[model samples]
Target: MGFSVRALDTDSWAAFAELVEANNGVWGGCWCMGFHVKLGKGRTAQQNREEKEARVQTGDTHAALVFEAEKCLGWCQFGSPDELPEVKSRRLYEKGLTTLPDWRITCFFTGKGFRGRGVADAALGGALAQIAQYGGGVVEGYPEETDDRKVSGSFLHTGPMSAFENHGFTRTRPISPHRWVVTRTV
Candidate 1:
C-alpha cells in the first residue's frame, strides 16, 4: 500500500488530531512544536500546542502532515527557517547553513503498526515534494541512529539516520555518534 503526505491545515485537522491521539501522546500533545518553542527556552506543553495550532491556523508554511488513506501515518514539521530555534542554535548548523529560504523537517512520528514499513520514508519524500511546491529547495533533517540499542519511537521522533539517508540526504556533520544533521537538495 502507498501513503500520501500533505500539510496539516484546517482541512487536515481531524486526521491530524487522530494521528496525534493514536501515537499515545508521545509528544505530550505537542503537535510537533518542541523545536518551535525555541532552544534554551522553556514553555508549558499547552503553550507549545497552542502556539503550533496558531501557526497552522495562520498558515505558517513550516508545518506539515502525511496520510495513508483515512489514516495519517507520518508528519514532518518544516518551513520557518529563522523561526526554528533548535536548528538555529546548533553550532554545527550555524557554520555553513544555507541562507536561501529552506524548510526544516524537525520531527516525525509513524503509527505503531505502520512503523518499520517505509512509512516515514514515503512521507519524507512527499514532504520534499511539498517543500519544492512551496518554493523551498533545501529540506533539512536531524535524526538519531543506533546499531542495536532500543529506544522508544517517541525518543526517536527526530527520526533515524537510515530513514533520511535512504531518502537521499547527505550527512552534513556528526553532532554525535548517534545524532547527525542530514540534508537533501531538491
Candidate 2:
C-alpha cells in the first residue's frame, strides 16, 4: 500500500502516540521532545508523554506523520528555532548559524519493522510541502553523512544527509564529526 502523510494535530495524536509507545517512549522517554523546550530531563516517560500530548492538543508541536493504512509508520519533526531550540553540538551550531531558517527539521522516527522502506524520505517530502503551504521560506536540518561507513538507524533520528540533499538542501556547515547543518529554501 502507498504511504499517506498528515499534519500532527489533535486528530493524528493517537497514531503518533501508538508509534512512540511501541518504541519504548522513543529513545528513552523523549516523546520527540529532545529538541523541544521541555527537554524531558529528569522527567518520567509518562510525564514527557503527557507534556507532548498537551502540546499536540494545543497545536504547539509540528511534524509530518507518515502512515500506512491508519498505522503511522514514521514522522519528520520540524518547527521554528524557538519551538525547537535544543540541538546536538549546540555550541558549534550557534557559532556558524548566520540566520535561522523559518523551519527546522529536528528529527525523524520510523516505526519498527518499517525501516529502509522510504518512510523518512516520505516524511521529509511531506514536511517540506507542508512548510510551503504555510508560506515557504528557508528550512534547515542537521543530518549525518554515512558515505564511508554505515551508521545505525537508531542513531539517525536526525535523519541522513542524503535525504535533505535529495530535497534540495545544501551543505552549509558542519557541527559534529559527521553531522552537518544543511539548508534549503522550501
Candidate 3:
C-alpha cells in the first residue's frame, strides 16, 4: 500500500490519538507536548494526555500524520516558535539563530511495528507541504546525527539529521554534540 499524510486536525484526532496510545503515550506520556508546554513537577501521564487532547480538540496543536490506507503509522509536530515554546538545547540553538524561523518541526513519532520504514521522512515532507499551504516560510528542525553509531529508535523521537536533509533542509548549526539545527525555506 502507498503511504499518505494529513494534518492532525479535529477530523484526524482519533487516528492521531490511537497512534500515540499505541506508543505508550509517547516518551513516557509526553503526548508530543514536550516542546509546546513545560511540564510542571509531578505532572501525571493522564494529565498530559488530557492537555494534549484538549489542544487537539481546540485546534491548537499542529502535526502531520503519516498513514497507510487509513491507519496512521507516524507523525511529525510542527508549528510557529510561539506555538512550540522550548526546545532541546535551547541555549545552543539560540546562539546560532540569526532570525526566528516561521515554523519549527519539534517532534516525531513512529508506531512500534513501523520503524525504519520511511515514516518519518514521509511525515516531514507532509509537514513542509502543510506549511506551504499557510504561505511558506523558514522551517527549522533539531535532529540527531547518529554518525553510524548504534542508537535506539526511542532516542530519535526528534528524528535524524539525514531525514531532514533528504527533505531539502540544510544544516544551519550544531545545537548539541549530536543534534543540529537545520532549516529550509519552504
Question: Which one is best on lDDT?
Answer: 2
Question: Candidate 1 — what's its lDDT?
Answer: 0.70
Q: With candidate 2 superimposed using the best TM-score fit, by how many Å does residue 75's alpha carbon deviate from the native?
A: 0.3
Question: Candidate 3, after superposition: displacement of residue 61 in Å?
Answer: 1.0
lDDT score of model 2? 0.91
lDDT of 3: 0.89
lDDT, candidate 3, 82-106, per-residue tens: 9898889988888877889999999
lDDT of 1 at 95: 68
**Candidate 1: minimum summed lDDT over ten consecutive residues — where?**
37-46
Each candidate structure's TM-score, on Cα atoms with residue i matched to residue i, is 0.82, 0.96, 0.96
lDDT values, one for every candidate:
0.70, 0.91, 0.89
Which stretches of model 2 miss by more than 4 angstroms?
38-41
Give the range of the ten consecutive residues with the poorest summed lDDT in model 3: 36-45
lDDT of 1 at 30: 62
The residue pairs in collision within model 1 are none
